[model samples]
Target: MRRNDCFFVSTNIFSTGFCSLRKIVRWMLVASMLTSMPVLAGKTLDGIKARGVISCGVSTGLAGFSAMDSKGEWHGLDVDICKALAAATLGDARKVKWVPLGSQQRFPALQSGEIDVLSHNTTWTLSRDASFGIHFTSIVYHDGQGFMVAKKTGISAVHQLSHADICVQSGTTSEKTLNDYFRAQKMKFRPVVFENFEASLKAFFSGRCQAYTTDASSLAAILQRETRNPGDYLVLAEVISKEPMSPAVRRGDDEWFAIVKWVVNALIVAEEEQLTQANLDTQKEHGNAVVQGLLGNADDIGKLLGLDRAWAYRAIQAVGNYGDIFERNLGSGSPLKLSRGANRLWTHGGLIYAPPIR
Candidate 1:
């Protein structure tokens, strides 16, 4: 029988009949072999697969969130998310291109298709969601705006520096937040702004400003790595605004958004099940139903997302677990040493939680 005749007789061809016999046969063959091959209706995932690398946007250098080593290796919480997505989709953690983006450039890069995912330290606000043609997938870090000052300045509280000169990075929520904060408090201050984060840190170090104001996590990072004297600076305890940092993707791509969102959930689920890269091989046979679903041992959770049964398994093995990613990048294992205060798992009295994979 002719190839077109074969597809027609079998009723396997899509309702929208194809013109070419060769195309019809190839589609049937692919369908038979890979039952769960993802439908790439959103061109973003297909583009990443075609290019053999997922372009991930990240901060130029934000210590535990996103930074580069002397050997040009990317490391941080944001970097791990990028790698995890690569591992889940392409089965290779290293199949990722890191695009270091500034605060203002990150969204534009994602919108322009320059990056597949923006995992930088970006706050999710109502205005950003409504204005930008972007969708925030999940909040990876719970943060807040705060102030940092040199210890010898005798500044202990937000109101202490009423007439202080503050260094802030331009084109960031921090810049505007800084302005609104002092104005609301009925205080006066000089606003010293720089285009880039490094320049703001440089100015802060040189005494161009008496204080540096930004997210508390960023303040901790500066104290850890950017300062000549780590002990000389103190991060104030007052959190001025809520900053929920999340990974964002261009809106209108439901498939790509699900892939990124589930990759993050896979990490958290792996951590909850105590499934580490070292123990994943054995844990696939774990008696717990949720663990079985997550490890692709039973029900094959990836089928729902049109991925291979082992997609989540590969991601967990590549990046260990969510806790592993956190500790390695931002906690005691790294320079930042940030305590997992609100970022801890729900079982441990923190907010990190994931839905069931079944």
Candidate 2:
């Protein structure tokens, strides 16, 4: 048997030989350290705290989803998500730097650490989820592909457009979905593809294409913002493909993932509890126990994610609940005038549902 300063000799009952317990302990320690490397090297929350602001990647300008106003202020459904995340992470919804991203720039910016979160209206597909080293938190919007045509075209249904030219963005799920749909229906059409939505809008308006196809929500935004007479254009009744739009974060950051996900759930839950920002103060005093727990009154739910107890409360106050956000940005009051069809709460016979705060 040999003994050294770093090694210890021990009897091994299983081997009838000398064994080094110190060596075994050293190996276990190394294994433990190796397992924790990801956490130590890349703490997304710590970096966000250090920066004092969350860099949120958003679309260039999509009218109702994430667009810049005349005064260069970002406002929309997606922008509210960023504000909600900032409120949850930093206890201030305004602690966010909006990074305008084109479709080509979004994933690269996220992967390169240029943005803390991609709150853009990006779809959650299996290929994107599996191939890209990114994680989708939760679906914030339930959307589907649809077509918009001039009222004078007299085209009432999707099947009526045979041999027609359609304007579409070049690199998007909408383009692929359009092809799949037209092919499935055995319809022939020319795709007037453009590199960006602006160009597609211009082409569609210039009469270069008979129809403009994209997510139905986007079609409404385009018509409301760019059209001379929105009444002249009609969004069709058919919704072609499922587009489960969600927020995404860099992979391997479970703490950040949970925080983003729960913030969205908190919004939905707040709506369910009728916890508006105006009544938040009053509700905290004498609200129901479930609402109190959800608002972080009776529980330390925020501390579980390295945040203050009022994190969810701050988020709801900043952007209102999911329903309020939808209505203000994309619903009746907004230019889009989108109805809360699938985006309504579960209690209202829609798909929007959140897990319990407990």
Best candidate, lDDT-wise? 2
Per-residue lDDT of model 2, residues 1-358, tens digit only: 3565224433234344324666788899998775544344348889889889999999998877899988989999899999998988897888999999988889988877778889899999999998888899999999999999988889999999899999999778998999999999999999998996678888888788889999999988888778889899899999999999999998888888899999999999999999898999899878999788888889798888778998988999999999899998999879889999999899999999999998
Per-residue lDDT for 1-358 in model 1, tens only?
6988988876755544554676889999997654323222487788788999999999988888889999999999999999999999999999999999987889888876778999999999999988898889888888999999888898999999898999988888988888898899999999998886778888888888889998998888878777777888889999899899899998777989999999999999888989998999888885488888887888877977767899999999898899999999989898889999989999999989988778
lDDT of each: 0.87, 0.88
Candidate 2 overall lDDT versus native: 0.88
Candidate 1 lDDT score at position 22: 69
C-alpha RMSD (angstroms) for model 2: 10.6
Worst 10 residues of 1 by lDDT: 32-41
* lDDT score, candidate 2, position 154: 96
